[model samples]
Target: MPSTKIGILETGGPPRELAERFGDYAAMMRRMLGEGYAYATYDVADALPATPEEQDAYIVTGSPAGVYEDHAWIEQLIGWLRQAKGRAKLVGICFGHQVMAEAFGGRVAQSDKGWGIGLHRYQLHERTEWMDHAAAIAIPVSHQDQIVELPPFSRIVGGSDFCRVGILAYEDQPAISFQCHPEFEPAFAKALIEARRDRLPDPDAAIASLDQPDDRERVAGWIRRFLDGLAAERS
Candidate 1:
């Protein structure tokens, strides 16, 4: 069989200094995803894919910006996602997750809970075969926004008190998204916390939490198995 074509729809990236050390968000995702598949990246600030359906699947990367921000490219990306739904599989992370929810009749905004850093745990509500039947998970997270309202036909995969819409799977679409960052290595997660020390309420605590065992590979497994399902279906 041929390699699956995976597109990286990048909306934002790490700080320039941190990126030099940890690689950009796309690179981090690629490392987590491993090899054997082909990848194409589109910097959404520059442009979205001319053909949304060209890739067998797309993994939307985390961004520093909010989904409600008035950016032309951000709006365009949402429109493209609407067109791409069901045409190709999508896996959204952080901002990607928020944007997908906003595009699909949901709402996203800065959480009153403030910044959520470190490894946050979520109770899995329901599991599909692709999820490997996991009932709970704790993955790296760095965000101030989350999906507050769910889209129609959305199924809850997992959630926690801090972020109710942490993980979601659509009933009528071949798509799923997570508010956590499975792509973040412990080092990168720590560095990100340190970089934003001024903005975070408890950077030291957040950085300390990174030392605990996390479910990075566990979430990555869910993503890999979920995406691998697309290979057999794609032409």
Candidate 2:
């Protein structure tokens, strides 16, 4: 068997001051997922892949910008996602999750719940084969925009009351998205909270929450299984 080629679309970057310590989002994701497949990082700000099938699957990284924002690249990315549906597996984290929702007929807006920074737990909604029988998982979250109306032809697979649409699975295509940041480790999550001290209401509490355990690796496994499952179906 050949190594799977996974395309990583980097929509944004980490705080400039923290990049030396934590590296970029794509680097964090590669480290979190470990080394089982061939990975390529594409800065979507420059250009999207010529074809959706350019890779076996694609993982859209989190961003600071909102889907509703009037950025030319963001709109192009949404269009690419619409075309990529079913052509290849798609996974989104945080802002990527929000963009995917907006692209697929769902709605996203500044959350009334405020900033969802720190480790948050989500209850599993179904025993999807890729779920690996896990009942619940806690991962770091850092987003103000929430998916209010889930996209068409999709089902909620996992999430918490605070973020009801935390995890979504598509019915018509091999795509899924999580509103949590499984790529953010404790140190990075803490730093992020500290950096956003001015915006968040209670930054100290959010930073302190990082001491708790998280399910970053577990969720990465879920993503791997999901992409593998899609590959098997096509084979």
User: Which candidate has the highest lDDT of all?
Assistant: 2
C-alpha lDDT of residue 90 in model 2: 95
Clashing pairs in 2: none
RMSD to the true structure for each prediction, in A, is: 3.2, 2.9
TM-scores of all candidate predictions against the true structure: 0.96, 0.95
Runs with alpha carbons beyond 4 Å of true place in candidate 2: 230-235
What is candidate 1's lDDT per residue for 1-235, written digit by digit as tens? 8899999999999999999999999999899999988999999999888887789999999998998889998889999999987889999999989898988889998999999999889999876777665668878899999788899988778989998899999888888999999999999999999998988988998888999998899788888888988221211
RMSD of 1: 3.2
- In the range 120-174, model 2's lDDT, one tens digit per residue, is 8999988677776678998999998999998999999999989999899999998
